[model samples]
Target: MENILEKLGIELNAETRLTGDSKFSFNCHSALSCFNTCCSNLDIVLTPYDILRMKNRLGLTSAEFISEYTEPVIQKESKLPFLKLRLGQEGKCRFVAAEGCTVYGDRPAACRYYPLGFGIYKNEEAGDDFYFLIKEEHCKGFGEQREWTVGEWRKNQGIDEYDDKNRVWMEVILNKKLYSPELEPDEKSLKMFFMASYDLDAFREFVFESRFLDVFDIEEERLEIIRSDDSELMLFAHQWLLFALFKKPTMNLKES
Candidate 1:
């Protein structure tokens, strides 16, 4: 862990010691050393799955959540949309509660991967693999007297579902280096990509209000699948985004 963290030029602290393959156990109890310590000083990136679950958990419309809790910006190098959570006063998360996370069941990938982070850097010469562990200044839970492996920790945290939904987004981010310089995106393409990828409610509105649905030759069955499954919706959403950005030809139909 130290070697990788060093390569990334990040610092290490008591809160973030490497226990690679070490058995560690954690649970919510009154005497826990760093009660709610994990809630402080967080910078979490939200995925589409997280947004859908959290909005449902809070009874929020997707558009409402995007406007209130998110800050969307483009990755300067790739011109890609990225979403980060907006912090409340004192730099704490808006969802932090007196006991623990109010949205514990619907927390973002970053929260689910606490004490561990993930990275995937794929390049022409060499590609990086996925990995996770504790980070600097994260010591609040290390003193726990229980034991479990990294794999078990993830299982207990309920991360597999988020991972499944995030797979396509991960592919887009990791494969950025694969795009040729000759295909640099213009302003319009960049704008569409940013909105389609980050701003969920806005995208939904566009789908409903614009001629977008009419422009795509989507089958009735596929539309039904997307309407029923958020993940399928995301997959189709990306297709439209790609078409918008690259001017790729798509099947044509009538507006619903």
Candidate 2:
């Protein structure tokens, strides 16, 4: 989403386009002079899996986490719902402390991808995935001696897992962008999207407490996975969204 980058104050041009093998010098630690600066004044968008991980890490349900720590914002162009991490007083991240991030182990994907921005292009001819350096003027991490290929950075930051988990969600957003004006989702569809994307706890209730299984033919083993594993549930949610929004045959209906 080019608009997302612009909103975050990142300007990308031909010179900044990077492939997986492209090397960059950057390292962030408490020892760095500019450490924790990036955590403040950011419009951090939380993915579904990001919320899942963070909420579980904090022992909070998805609904509670959304209510206490996030603010919902609709993307201006895509008209899609995005849950942004709420900053505290002085415009600093609530999780940021004097030493470093308190929730460092379970930080959001955008925090994990610091100094490197990731995006996908929808062009049929050219390549789709690309990365670019954010090189903020005040970030001294770029001046460090440590160097890494984009792939290495992604691996070191555990970004691959986040990206993998978020792939289907990204596809949905991209599809919405591509079909904008032709496919305008109603208020109910938007609420469904938000629930499936951010409110995992509510989605769980919707799946189990409702007639969802009575209508859809989910296998016993898959149902168990969705019941116990948040990741699997997120995947199921994506499939459900595809079926609900685009009428894709991602799920089969039970026969009467």
Candidate 3:
């Protein structure tokens, strides 16, 4: 998740590097003076699952949510599209209020994992996945007595589900980072990536309304799932990307 950390202007080092068993003391409550301070001036990049959940929670179409509350960014190094949450006036998060986060239950993974950042470093020999602390000077949550392992904190914050849903999307990103330099995506491919990753409604339309099914041999049961389940559709999008971009055998083509 280097893309995420870089977008947030956060750089991890030896001091912040943590394993699953690593322990830290942190807690956030309305009683704290910094209750909602971290909600502002953030560079929260929304994952595909994040957009999926948030749009569903607000009863907004993916296109509407993207248009109204997100700003699309093309990463400089990877040249891949990234969506950042649009802050309201005064740099406050659009979903944050005086009471706290209005959409707390369906909050973005970044917000849910506050004071902790997840990352994966791609080494030539082996990849390294780990978590790290974001010890911002203004965050008093670290001073709290409630200590927990990174694994426990992830469970408590409901990050496991988000991570699981976003796994394939993250793999796509990692593949892009590793190979995009060698092969630059054209405009049409970029548009497909954007739609598949962020605009689920548009992707749904593309799948059902376009010739997508005509070319690919998707099973009937899988098609049924994709027809009604947004999560399943998102996973199908990742598979489509793998087939389209990497020439992976994720799907079979219709025989002539």
Candidate 4:
């Protein structure tokens, strides 16, 4: 998916460009775009909130939604786990409505940003920066009626809060090589990353129906925290990634 985006020239300047001092305006009504034409032809990644909200909107259980709607696939070369939202017959987003987005309030961060998108990159020295830009080919909202600066758009879209929540996962994702460049990941690692990062249904099953709780010790309080905060999950996931890649066993649950 990332490769496709790159091949299509959809660069990931996630933070800097979108959040910077540029100005733009967008409004669906005035823009003469009543429906989602821009949602086609790309693999949109779904966050955990995206899965939950979309499932509830579609009136399906987490398990039911995943099995019926999604497929688990790794991004090429990097072998990173991410969920691709299944598209319709015409390559339209499944949740797109004739009226607008069916799940507007809880739409993914990527969707909320519209024509402007964000990306983050890590330098060899561990420094990270953000970039923003207009998307390719099909986006018509760039010349819409409303107007806003990059900062205004970020504030309006609540991207700062979203970034704050997703930072831990972002850190782990960007720093994969730092933990172990030569780690030969097995099927278990793939499944683990997929469940934890992408598929909410499988993740829920692993947390509730499986012995993940029994084998890896998470305290009641921390478990409660993870239930509420994705940052907490990312922190826990980072620990799991460390164990998975470097083989450093963290057996002392009390230590956390």
**C-alpha lDDT values of all predictions:** 0.67, 0.87, 0.86, 0.63
What TM-score would each prediction reach against the true structure?
A: 0.78, 0.93, 0.93, 0.75
Q: Model 4, residue 241: displacement in angstroms?
A: 3.9
TM-score of 4: 0.75
Cα lDDT of model 2 by residue, 144-223, tens digit? 89999999999999999998999888877777443567766789989999989988878999999999989999899998
Model 1: lowest-lDDT 10 consecutive positions: 13-22
lDDT of 1 by residue, 19-78 (tens): 335455554454666667677666677787788788878888777888899987665557
Q: Indicate which candidate wins on TM-score.
A: 2
Better of 2 and 3 by TM-score: 2
Report how far off residue 2 is in candidate 2 (Å): 4.5
- For model 1, state the Cα shift of residue 42 in Å: 1.9
Q: Model 4 off-target regions past 4 Å?
A: 1-19, 30-34, 124-127, 135-138, 178-181, 199-217, 224-239, 246-256
Candidate 2 lowest-lDDT run of ten = 176-185
Ranking by TM-score: 2, 3, 1, 4
What residue pairs clash in candidate 1, if any at all?
Answer: 15-138, 15-139, 24-148, 115-133, 115-134, 116-133
The root-mean-square deviation over C-alpha atoms between each candidate and the true structure, in angstroms, is 4.7, 1.9, 2.3, 4.4
Return whichever of 1 and 2 wins on lDDT.
2
Candidate 4 per-residue C-alpha lDDT over 178-222 given as tens digits, one digit per residue, 9 for 90 to 100: 335566457777777666664554564566677677677777898
Better candidate number, 3 or 4, judged by TM-score? 3
Off by over 4 Å in 2: 1-14, 123-127, 176-178
